[model samples]
Target chain A: MPNTLILSIDAMGGDHGPSVVIPAVDIAARQLGDVRFLLHGDQAQIEAELAKAPAARAASEIRHADKAIAMDEKPAQAMRRGKGSSVWNAVEAVKDGQAAAAVSAGNTGALMAISMLVLRMAEGIKRPAIVASWPTMNGISAVLDVGANVESDAEQLVEFAIMGAAFHHAVHGSTKPTVGLLNVGSEEQKGHEEVREAHALLRANSFDFDYRGFVEGNDIAKGTVDVIVTDGFTGNVALKTAEGLARFFGNELRATFKSGPLAMLGAVFASGALGAMRKRMDPGAVNGGPLLGLNGIVVKSHGGADAPGYAAAIRVAADLARSDFTAEIDRNIRRLGAVVSESAASPAEGAAE
Target chain B: MPNTLILSIDAMGGDHGPSVVIPAVDIAARQLGDVRFLLHGDQAQIEAELAKAPAARAASEIRHADKAIAMDEKPAQAMRRGKGSSVWNAVEAVKDGQAAAAVSAGNTGALMAISMLVLRMAEGIKRPAIVASWPTMNGISAVLDVGANVESDAEQLVEFAIMGAAFHHAVHGSTKPTVGLLNVGSEEQKGHEEVREAHALLRANSFDFDYRGFVEGNDIAKGTVDVIVTDGFTGNVALKTAEGLARFFGNELRATFKSGPLAMLGAVFASGALGAMRKRMDPGAVNGGPLLGLNGIVVKSHGGADAPGYAAAIRVAADLARSDFTAEIDRNIRRLGAVVSESAASPAEGAAE
Candidate 1:
């Protein structure tokens, strides 16, 4: 077998912590034999949870970190202050090449800050974006910059589109992902000046991926497009809205079954089908979102995620490691750089700093 | 009981036209006994549908219009060219004092354009905003300028917040509505430069209703606050995203219950609860969005709405008319203008034109 895909997990993160993370990691390791985990957190808490799974303990190793990052702390300040935090330590493993990837269910802002501060952006990346895959009717559609960079210009949006397309292809195994800019309307000249200018830039580029015009808010869940690109502000709103609606729908479904006898009977008959649908729509199944365009692999799990959710996140990290996504992204970046350099007078090389 | 709330219905505006509009009018006229409708559209088509509803025919009146506006035409160009269109006639009825309010499930852009052109803004109002209500767990929250004025400055956003607050109170029956500025974060000092300045402006005028500081995307549907305010671009995205999720949730629920026999049984038992849930989440029940701050009453319905949905729009328009929303809005506008005048010098009286 190829060398094990080592994933560094921030066990102290999330509401459930090692109680959920330990079981989830055990389940994932058992299912994917080639995967091993470096659990980073307080050694005592992690060991107490892992004690239940002696076999998993033998399969995985623990890397203790004394401190943990609080969710509400300012991302930049916390990264500077929490030098020994589990999130920081987990990311450090990837930066030092101790692990192929890192997974955290801690503060998203902190994760993004530490990832950027430590591993830095990959070659040709103007800014790193957070990309999440949401389950859709057709399959799954990937939305980028959900909350990474809140304020982005037209160039950054275009770059996000390119990165999103590449990430979708790399992770989902799609040949030519159909990328679209999320907007109020699908017309050629809709949306604000940023979107309008970004549309022009994206259209002019000769990327191998298919730029499938613009998509509306409703199109994301319908799975109409494979990759949806937007500024972090809009993208974050769309993602959160989707999550909120899913919760609302789940509550509504539960309420529907409890109304009366006839309805209760109807629900009984629909339990199996409903269960399947629930599984498909389960956020846990689509738990992890890769922090794309980073130098090292880092995945951010939902803050409220449980053991099964953490396990799924580990699976996503392992899959990225196995697929050589970073290498592919690096190659595309260089290709993009060459194209950009030839067409336009390349901006001064040191412009990013 | 009270003077019937007169609502002019553009019977020829929607995709289905009189086929949907007439039946919906009839339903509203019967359900809401203290309401009357003036249906304006193709004489023959509307008459044909109205003939089917004997009771509604007796209650509601029809005013014929020779032409209808197509969805694809430019809003201004169409309104200018198609002077005798149903939308125009309906607005004319409202302006002429023959109808208390005008409601249309027509081309949204056309409706807004014509409403602004014909009715104009209220005397002290700078711009007319299209305000829509988002259904939330707490109740309902109003988001303004879904697509009224695309590019807005700090002053305009402050104006929107003021107008949106009045609207929530007038229509939603919200007392002391908590008005929030929709930003990327809840901090008073966050968001783009324009939003940041607007936040300061709103904070300075603390006497103007209950200003609840800032809110984010997730808060819109949670109904954390009563009135959520944002510029047209962000507001449009939030409104559309919420609508899309509602539809997606419905479809997912249906698919989940219909998968197999056991699932079917489960759905049967859950049917009553589901119906109650669906009732609460139904878009048709919350169909109309008033074009607030206009000199005359105008309500816009969703493009894809059906008869039942159209009926709800009529009810909303009637409710607004009966509640003296215009008078309430006018009072607040004057109050706000007085406060603004005191804080800063009045902007040369007629800066709006």
Candidate 2:
């Protein structure tokens, strides 16, 4: 059936590596059928782990990659030297059309750098942006440019908005996702000169997505905006800060729940409720983030992700592949390109420009 | 006794205005001895609210102010037109030496703009920075430049480091607080050119404070560094994200604890534990943030603060006034200024420069 969704996963990536990735893959494959995984890493370690699970052994294939990219290595240097590294090899599988998508829980910088170099940008993408979704009070909100292209111009940010909107629609099933430009204030004249200009550009462009105007930092979790866009620097800081606070709150809740007999009894009785709360708050459910505006699929799982987290990433890759999201983005990009070209020739005419 | 630790509070500010501020002042007066509040606002409204509180009737003084600064108004325009506004009058009290410090839960932009215009920058200070603190897993970390200066140069960021360090030491009672430059990576060479240059400048200026090198987003909750410094844009986004996540988590917990009968039982037993958790996670505890490097003391409380939150702001202002934090900062600025001047004159002789 159109050659079962094949994912090339970096086995030696993340904090726990094969120990976590293997179990996660096994769980995902067991739950979701018609999925094949090409696990790339050292053969011996992977085989040793795979030997423990018959289901995993049957569902996955091993591809050897002798090298691993160090977390500290510079992205450019790592890409230059790591010809056979797990990250590079996994990306290569996508490039060679052997795999529909590539997943990595390794060094984010290396992954982004390799994806850009190997898969290259989609037809009209000036720069690919990293987009992630955060658990909000209502549901979830997607934020883009979280460490992709650290220094982006107005045009790059506009591209990020387009990609981010498409991602929300593809992944979250959002129809006409509201796009917002993140700024210090919601007022039109509030942010830096770049933000003001980007605001004008987003407004003038008559894209399929719903442009919701500017959004503030506090509005992120309020679920007021569907897709929030910003430069990589601000987006990165915002994402990490949300992550830090989530972890902090989790720790505090756990500590408080085990403080005394009353708390322990409460936790026991509220097990069902607590389980529901845990599921809602767990970062694992929202573990994978797609690198948008890329020609091929690349999903970066959390670096500290466990087996369950990795499993989620694999499912994400499969979903994107099944929906032909890349084809959709390509068509949209070509349409946008025509509009851009015409605008340049005409100087100022058409709402699309 | 010591002028009763007079605090000039903008009673006409914030979402709830004197309704919240008056009750907070009343509570603080009854709770903390020898604390006098000079409340500036519409005299009639202030008195009407003061009459509601038994303690406020005797403890607070109502100072008449004819206008109020709107939250969305331009900072410079607000300063020029709002001379008779409560926020302006509050700062005027500090300028006239009637109050030790000025506290406002009003428009942060307006507060900083007026504070800079009226109080001016400290002798060696090129720009004043807004510093905020939030509860982290490892206690608290102070983040500076939370929307003080939108665009920052290398020198401004370095000065932020020094100012943030002094703030942590004076307010948080830390001895030789460690200062870190907030970046995307912990590596020395990572981040923008400005961040890299700032890192070197911080390391070179031995006379300023203890420079703990670079820190990333995840390090914020780790409390590895006491004072984290960055530009206003990054810092503002980070602070707001953290605050938003905390609220999101708290709401999730509450919803889960009220799901069913079992959840209700758990909530009843865990009431004490839940209370403890709430206390720790309460935004009020970290209500007010000082606008550092200004000649006079100015504290900006959250705009959404309620009575208890306003009380926390008042207490913070009073404590800062008693500590003579401004004088400490001024003295350090002189030392830093001398070092900067000497290094400039010698060109290559200074050890750190």
Candidate 3:
């Protein structure tokens, strides 16, 4: 742990728990060498699963946690009685400097609550944002706040731009990442007042990342911008809407192939092309969402994510830990003085600074 | 025109005014079998295009308008100085009872303004809503207030519920169209307060539509409910986001097939299946968004939609005109008392009643 990059894993979280997490850790450890796993959960269950992966077993140490937060637990309840839980301990590892980052597949609200309590917000962040890698025609774009805050103002949206760009930079190694404010339309007359305000402010001032003014919902999948900034409400809806549509598209294509004898024959002939298309668009192929704006890195894998999907999330955590992500965020926040200065009086802000 | 169903056409509206409208009316006349078109625009341009379609010329009467509303014109400015414009005349045809419904592929703001001014809102409708058919997994569902009103209160959302259900019923012939308030989550406490309030109201009070409780953005394309109720801002963003994703999916699939020789060869074999999928999912295949709550039906085609798409919108107008859509809306609005009672004093309310 002293020399190796370490990630804390909440082994008790997710649908399959240790069954999926252990294998994912094994995959992550293999792909990213010199990484140690601090597994938090039932020791017996984890040990059993770890035995199957000799490399992971050799590189990992299990830390027993008494409770595992329920998938349906309320955030408030998780905060009140989440001490020593698997997710709590996992997040705590990052705070204690035992791990560089934390990965979890627990309830989103619960994980966010515990992470905020343990790791806290970075200096000057009004609220932490949940960022996801949206697969676009031109590779992937970073979209935030996917559901960290319910609503946002001009200042908050401005903050999202900086954080989103930083996240994109950390993960994709793209400097001067183009950021756009996600609105209904690029027209000045369109969108809610806050969106218009953010658009104007972002356009008027220069930031560390390249601000690309206002972009419509249509521009999101066009890869029109590297980082899409929006209020949590719109961002959350856009993300889910895209997911739903993508699934619908996939389902419709599959249904079309199975509609009749002629279609089925065509399916056999074009099986390779169809299979390639599916593989390219598979959600599992890109499952992790990084909870950004926190003092330490936290990667949230989908609860239903499979071994490869969970491994993807673990890799995201590992990548963020290896980069200067936290320091970069701190510098960007400092550069965006207005956003932080507004909420500068909080104790958390001082501690983060 | 005595025995035929008549549709008013705004020939000077879309990207390619007469080129799109004349051809679309021609296609629609062939599809519907017994339909008359009242073409309103520059007489010279209308006459030239009508010559291309003998069927359209036989079924249409060209009415010359002095002005054509620019696609980028503001709604208020259009209303203030757009008298005798093609769009204005189209709405006037509906007001004069010469056409049962009007179809336009113009600036949305301009169309809505002209329609509202000439045709007016239905009795007891607080504000007219833009309702569109959303392609979903199970089937097509109607989603409403898709940029009609930027913000909505609980009462307005309830009204949208009524209008959406009525629109669905009129178009799809479903007796009790299921209605759901669009929210960030399925939970009771997941969206704007107005949304939660609407959820409670809809759940508590019975209506013509089956009131399902809260649904998330993902549910919009899942066909979870027949009608999705939301403010224009959220609904507009969700609709465009889905469109962006659908386009992205199609683009990605095409690119994947073109990536290599085996894939391209497979694509050739699966061409039939792939074509069927594209045709089924093509936005043009179902290109008509009815502007609900107006006293007379107004169908809006996508401005950039081509022949088949514009024809689809005209067909939608024809279908609505054939049905008692306006009456159904009136009855539903009357049933949802809270919505109308708020803005019940408007002149359009009186005229419709």
- Using Cα atoms with residue i matched to residue i, what is each candidate's TM-score against the true structure? 0.89, 0.89, 0.92
Query: Which of the CAPRI classes, incorrect, acceptable, medium or high, describes model 3?
Result: acceptable
Instruction: Compose the digit string of candidate 3's lDDT tens values, residues B1-353.
Output: 47689889999888999998888888888899888889999999999998899989999999999999998988889999989998899989999999889998889988998889888887877888898788777688898888888778887899899888888887877888998888778877676667766776676556888898888788887889999988887788777777777777778777876877766665666667777677666433578998888888899998988988899888888878887777777776676675445544322111000
| Runs of candidate 2 exceeding 4 Å displacement | A48-61, A70-73, A282-285, A334-353, B1-4, B30-36, B48-62, B70-77, B282-285, B335-353
Q: What is the TM-score of chain B alone in each candidate?
A: 0.89, 0.88, 0.91
Lowest lDDT 10-mer window, candidate 2 chain B?
A: B344-353
Write candidate 1's Cα lDDT for A58-121 as tens digits: 7778888999888787776777887888889999999898899998888877788888898998
The full ranking of all candidates by DockQ, starting with the best, is 2, 1, 3
Which is the leading candidate under lDDT?
3
| Local error of candidate 1 at residue A271 (angstroms) | 3.9
Candidate 1 structure quality by residue, lDDT tens digits, B246-325: 66667887777676667766765665566567667643347788888788889888777888888878877877777757
Tens digit of per-residue lDDT, candidate 2, span A1-353: 38688889999889888888888888888977898889999999999889886677888999999998886677778879978999899999999999999999988888888898899988878888888877677677788888875567666777887888777777878877888888877777666767766677677667767888888787788788778898887888777766666666667768877899999889888877776676666433487899888889999998888788788888878878777576666665665666555554322222110
Stretches of candidate 1 off by over 4 Å are A272-276, A282-285, A334-353, B1-5, B31-37, B50-62, B149-151, B269-276, B283-285, B334-353
Indicate the TM-score of model 1.
0.89
**True-vs-predicted CA distance for residue B17, candidate 2, Å:** 3.8
